[model samples]
Target: MKRIAPAAERNKDPILEVLRPLLRDGATVLEIASGSGQHVIHFASVLPAVTFQPTDVDADARRSIEAYRAETGAKNILPSLALDAASDTWPVHSADAVVCINMIHISPWSCCEGLFRGAARILPAGGALFLYGPYRFFGVFTAPSNEAFDASLKAQNPAWGVRDTDQLLALAAETGFAHEETVPMPANNHCLVFRRL
Candidate 1:
C-alpha cells in the first residue's frame, strides 16, 4: 500500500517552485531519503520532462514508493533504489542533481557528512545538490518551533538534531561544493542549494 505523509503533501508544491528554475529539462534528479514517496510522485507529475530517481534506506519506504509510482502511472519516476546516506558506496554512480529533503536533522551527523562526500563523488562540476529542512544559523535555531523540534529529535536520539548552517557550509566547502543560495520555506524550514565546484 502507498503511504501518505502529510508533511510531504504540504511541502511538495513549495519545494517544486524552488526546483523549477534549478532543474533543467531531461535532467536526472536523485532524491535521497524519499520517505513515503509522496514528494517524488508530485514532482514527477509536474516535471514530466525530468526523470526522478527516488531512494531510501528502508525497504518499507521503497515499497511505498513503488506503490505510489504504480498508482500515479508516472512514467518519469524510476524504481526506488536502496540507498543509505552513511554508506561509502552508492547504487547509482552519477546524477545531474541531488535532492535531499528533511534528512539532515533526522539522521546522524556522520550521515550528513557521507551525503556530502557521496554527492561530491557523483556530481560533475556545476551539478546541483538541494537540501531542505530546518537548520540552525550561527549555532542558533532559526525559530522557536525548530528549537523545540530539535530538542524532541535529540530526546529521541542524541545524534539527531538540527544542524548548523556554518558547519554545513564548511562541510560543503571541504567536499568541493559552493553554497549557492538559501531560500526560507514555510514552517520555519529552509531550502539550501549548493553547486559542485
Candidate 2:
C-alpha cells in the first residue's frame, strides 16, 4: 500500500519552483530519503525530461516510492534504491544532481557528513546538490516554530536537531562543494543549493 506524507504534498510545489530553473532536461536527479515518494512523483510528472532516482534507507519507503511510480506511470521515475546517508558507499554510481528534503534534521549529524562525502565522490565538477529543511543561522533559530521543532527533535534524539547553516556550509566545503544559494521556503524552511567544485 502506498503511504502518504502530508508534508511532502504541501512542500512539493514550492520545491519544484526552485528546481525548475536549476535542472536541465535529461539530467539524472538522485533524491535522498524519499519518504512517502510523493515529491518524486510530482517532480517527475512536471519534469518528464529529467530522470529521477529515489532512494531511502527504509524498505517501506521504497515500497511507497515504487507504488507511486506505478500509480503515476511516469517513465522518468526510476526504481527506488536502498541507500543510507551514513554509509560510506552509495549504490548508484553517478548523478547530475542530488535532492534531499527534510532529512538531516531527523537524522544523526553523521548522516550529513556522509551525505556530503558521498555526493563529492559521485558528482562531477559543477554538479548540484539541493537540500531542503529548517536550519539555524549562526547558532540562532530562524523562527520560534523552528526553535520548538528543534527542541522536539533533540528531545526525541540528542543527535537529531536542526543544524546550523554555517556548520553545514563548512562541512560542504570540506567535501569540495561551494555554497551557491539559500532560498527561503514556506513554513520557516530553506532550500540550500551547492555546487560541486
Candidate 3:
C-alpha cells in the first residue's frame, strides 16, 4: 500500500535544501524512522549520487517504504530494513551520515537516547547526524503552535512530547556527539545538526 504523509509532501523540499550541501556524493545516508518513505524517495531522486538506506520499526512503515521505492524507481534507495533506535544492535553497522525526521517528539525519550547511542557507534568522527522536527529551546516552546503541538503529543502519550534541545544536546554529548548547528524551518520546526565527536 502506498501511504502518504502530508507533512512529508510539504517539508521535503526545504529539508532537501539543507541536506544538499551537507551530504557528499557517493555517501550512504541512513534515514531512521522513515515513515511512509516519502522523504527518502524524494531525497534519493534529488541526490542521485548518494545512496539512501531507509529503516523503520513498524511493519506497515517498512511496506510503505518499499512501495514508495518501487513507485519511484529510485536506484539509489536500498531495500527498507527493520530498525529500532532503542535496540542494542542495529541491522547496519556504518553510514556516512544519519538522518531522523519528525521522530523524537513522537516517540519516548528513551528512543532518542538509543538513537544517539547507536549513531555514536555507527558514525565515524566528524560524521553528521541530522534531526528535524519541533523542539523546545531552553525549556521553553519557541512558538504557541509548538506548545499546542507538544500538548497534543503528550495527550496522545505522556512519554511523547516536544523535547528540550538543551536536554537532547546533553544526551548527545554523553554519547560522544557535539551539537553543531540549528536551522529554522517552516511551521515552527527546526533542523538540528550534530557531529560525532
Cα deviation at 100, candidate 3, in Å, is: 0.0
Clashing pairs in 3: none
- Could you list the CA RMSD of all candidates, in the order they appear? 0.6, 0.6, 0.7
Q: What is the lDDT for 41 in model 2?
A: 94
Model 3 ranges with Cα > 4 A deviation: none
Q: What is the lDDT for 70 in model 1?
A: 87
What would the per-residue lDDT of candidate 3 be over residues 1-197, giving only the tens digit for each residue? 98899999999999999878889999999999999999999999889999999999999999999988888888999999999999989998999899999999999988999999999999999999999999999999999999999999999999999999999999988999999999999999999999998
Q: Whole-model Cα lDDT per candidate?
A: 0.95, 0.94, 0.94
Model 1, TM vs. native? 0.99
Point out the worst 10-residue segment of candidate 1 by lDDT: 1-10
> Local error of candidate 1 at 51, Å?
0.6
Q: Find the number of clashing residue pairs for candidate 2.
A: 0
Count backbone overlaps in model 3.
0
Give one digit per residue, the lDDT tens place, for model 2 in 1-197.
79898888899999999987878998999999999999999999999999999999999999999999999889999999999999998998899999999999999999999999999988989999999999999999989999999999999999999999999999998999999999999999999999999
TM-score, candidate 3, is 0.98
Kindly list the per-residue Cα lDDT of model 1 for residues 116-164, writing each as its tens digit: 9999989989999999999999999888989999999999999999999
